[model samples]
Target chain A: MQINLALAQIATKLGDVQSNLEKHLDLIEQAKARKADLLVFPELSLTGYVLQDLVATVAHKPTEDDPVFKHLLKASHDLDLVVGFVDEDSRHRFYIASAYLSGGRTLHVHHKVYLPTYGLFDEGRFFAWGDSVRSFDTRFGRVGMLICEDFWHASPPYLLWLDGADIMLFSSASPGRGLNDKEKLESARWVERVTKAYASMFTSFVAHSNRVGYEDGLLFWGGAVAYDPNGELIAQGPYFEEALTVASLDLNQLRRTRARLPLLRDERTNLVQKELDRILSK
Target chain B: MKIDLSINTNLARTILTAFIKSEITRADYSRAVINLSGGLDSALSLALTVEALGAENVLALRLPYRTSSPDSLEHAQLLVDQFKVRSETIDITPMVDPLFERDPQMSKTRKGNLMARARMIVLYDQSEVFKGLAVGTSNKTEILLGYSTQWGDSASAINPIGDLYKTQVRQLSQALGVPQPIIDKAPSADLWEGQTDEGELGFTYAEVDQLLYLLVDERYSPQECVEAGFDAKFVDVVVKRVRRSQFKRMQPPIAKLSNRTVGYDFLYLRDWGT
Candidate 1:
């Protein structure tokens, strides 16, 4: 199977939700025009970075019957749209989430697991940490979604890979400042290397998208990239600027890659489970 | 002319003490590290830290640039001598010159900021080595006027003096018996030749502190500020600075999916225990 994917590197302005949504709509149209089967956006593409107190003021709920969700569903008809948002749950805690829009409806929302609360990041001060790892079935294959800090921890993506996810999508609004851009690139490289290395053993692909712009005092450097099952860079975007980059992946290649490197066939889950239990135990 | 005013020393001490205690508990910090600049703000913050965490738990770092005034060093030494606490001196000139040589076009403001950040880098490095927290010394006056640099002097693991006005800092410093020279000397960033805080800010420390007290502490509007005898121009300057520097006070916005954030989320420092 051949899959065409478009990653939108939208430049976001702080606290400008309406303008950001308009930009997202325009990019969705652009992705459609490029004849892409799947489109991914940066984290929080609707509200921009550093919304500060405006998050409390601007964040809205998206119920099954909400117009915003309905609008996105209509736009994403026949295409798989993965976009980030700040959603208010029933418990009233805000979550940094990404919603999967396909078949003219909201399919699922994945909340960020690891909330960074040190240095320039204060996610712990904002959103609640999600407890679940979600993977959905698509026409292309079984796909998994993870937010920025989710990929930093080994457990989430590792579980997704083990659970038969053929592809992983990462969305991030990682800040671009000082050495952050370099860190972001290095992090993306690590994700690609680790996930695709796993993918080569198990056969999967990974798509990573990040945002770009000056929001408040922070800068978001967009360096979107993707890797094939063999950990080869199939597509790479520019740093510190916005651009939509697309790539084509063949599922047959993934199968062949896994056939050559059959490390997953070696049964070692029992040993690994013991080690994990020891580490996670109180 | 004695104006009718309420001066609750207990209330003031309680507010400062509560803020310090809460800040430490929130960050899970056991100790604090501060730069004793021999200025009122630093002196007040040092005193507060010592009062809240004891002298044994607080470490004072006296960082002097090559061109720092002799009086500044004297006052810093005076504080250490009075408190009988451990203090160390690290000259930042050597660390900052190479960067300046490479980027000669760096402005005085930029150089000052680099010096501030370099000093903080040392303080934080020491904090890691000592297992302590870096306490900030910026006063509310400076925060209101955008007088500090982001990630430079403005960066800290915690700030005990950020909400206090400059005049309040002086009063607290005197109450804490910080040396007279530190309290008396004109405020300066000591970034370059012939530089003073008032010269750059276009207002005296006394005037700015008074205006800020009436405006920010009292929550006076701009018109009310002018009617209270503050120059409209000065009020406008401070208000504009506060508005422009509002970004420094917040976390970078992540797209909200959950309901509670620092700005949007309703979690309090007290909630950490729960």
Candidate 2:
């Protein structure tokens, strides 16, 4: 099977859901016109990142009654959509989350497992940490979603790969920092290298959507990218600008790459779990 | 242990210009007001602001005290002409003299602070009429070393170059094509006769910038910096200055008495809904 994927690298207005929703709707139409099967937006595409106190103000449930998700769900009837937003739970605790909407219904909602609170990030202070990292089924295939910092760790992607996720969709509102590198922002260079590594190691297609724009002093470098199961660069968007980059992913590459590598088929889960249990118990 | 303070000028230029443009326009202001000191920091900032907002939208002000160096005004004019930015030469002598006159025996340090605050006052007044944001010119070196007066040159609606060290500022200034004279000359607050930043700080910017890079950016300890070939005394002084000036880099700590105090619990980005 082949899938047309759209990376919506957008600049979101901080704490303004209405304006950002309009941007999402416009991008959805553009991606649909380009014959995209799935459109992925950067993390916090609805509620902008760097919202400390405004997290609650912009938080929403994925239910159709919610104002922002309502329009996004309606748009998903045309094509599948992956969007980032602040998710509010029953106790009113918020989590940085991404939802997959297909055929006007929420298919899977992944609350970001990693809340980066260290230097230049304050997500942990405002939002509750997520406790899950599970991939779900779609019409196209079984896929997984991870927010920015979640993919930085090895375990989340490893868990998804073990759970049979053939397509890893990643999103971020990563700020541009460190000008030491000549070719790209240090953050951008690191993210690209890691995503490609995940694609190659897991033998699964990886698509990363990063936002572009400035919020307060943070500048999000929007260089969205995709790698096929063979770990070859398939698509990339421009940096520091809003863009909708579409790439054709040959899902058959998964079978081809796995047949050659056979790394995923080699079973070691029980041994790995035994050691982890022993080490963690200590 | 060697630290590379060099930055990719192209990357820096793209991000910094975008920062100035976005931060200013997001606040509903297309214009920016900068205090042109004829020094490298202000020159680089003005050049960048022009690139971000346009030569027409930037209002460069030459706020000179009577005691300020003549080269200060002349160098400032070079940038004003080079960028063709809108400019005004407002002599802050009259505004600051009243305060200086009240205390004839005031120290030069006190006078410099008064002059800085007075220039900010004029800069802010011009920003109101010109309807632009006041762009700050303080670099990371001076800010970390506590070399600037509080509420003076440090005041701005947004600062694009606050993260760049002095040496890095020169590197960026050269890349941005700021006049050679501005980059070559000794940096100064120009508060009094023959005052220089390095002379007062007791070290060159190049030396301190490297030490600061390790101590701050690389997260090296003072002992680590000393072990990294810096003089022990130099490391101590830089570390002490950075620690002492912590107050200058933060908003005043609010005493928490309620469920959510402004600075304590009510943390929101400055760009929230603006």
Identify the leading candidate in terms of DockQ. Answer: 2
Off by over 4 Å in 2: none
Across residues B147-227, which tens digit of lDDT does each residue of candidate 2 receive? 899999999999999999999999999999999999999998889989999999999999999998888888988998888
**Top TM-score model:** 2
lDDT tens digits, residue span A47-143, model 2? 8999988988898899899878888889999999999999999999899999999999999999999999999888889889999999899999999
The complex in candidate 2 yields a DockQ of 0.77
Candidate 1 Cα misplacement greater than 4 A, ranges? A60-64, A177-202, A278-282, B1-274
lDDT for model 1, please: 0.75
DockQ of each: 0.02, 0.77
Per-model TM-score of chain A alone?
A: 0.90, 0.99
True contacts kept of 2: 0.79
Candidate 1 per-residue lDDT, tens place, B1-274, comes to 1111222343345445545654565467768888887778888878888887878888889899988887777888887778766788999989998998998788987889889889888898888876778888998789888888777778777776676667667776777788887888888877776788899989887787777666665678889888877788988988887899887777777777776655555533321221
Q: How high is each candidate's TM-score?
A: 0.52, 0.98
Q: Whole-model Cα lDDT per candidate?
A: 0.75, 0.93
**Residue B206 Cα positional deviation in candidate 1, in Å, after optimal superposition:** 36
Could you give the CAPRI-style class of model 1?
incorrect
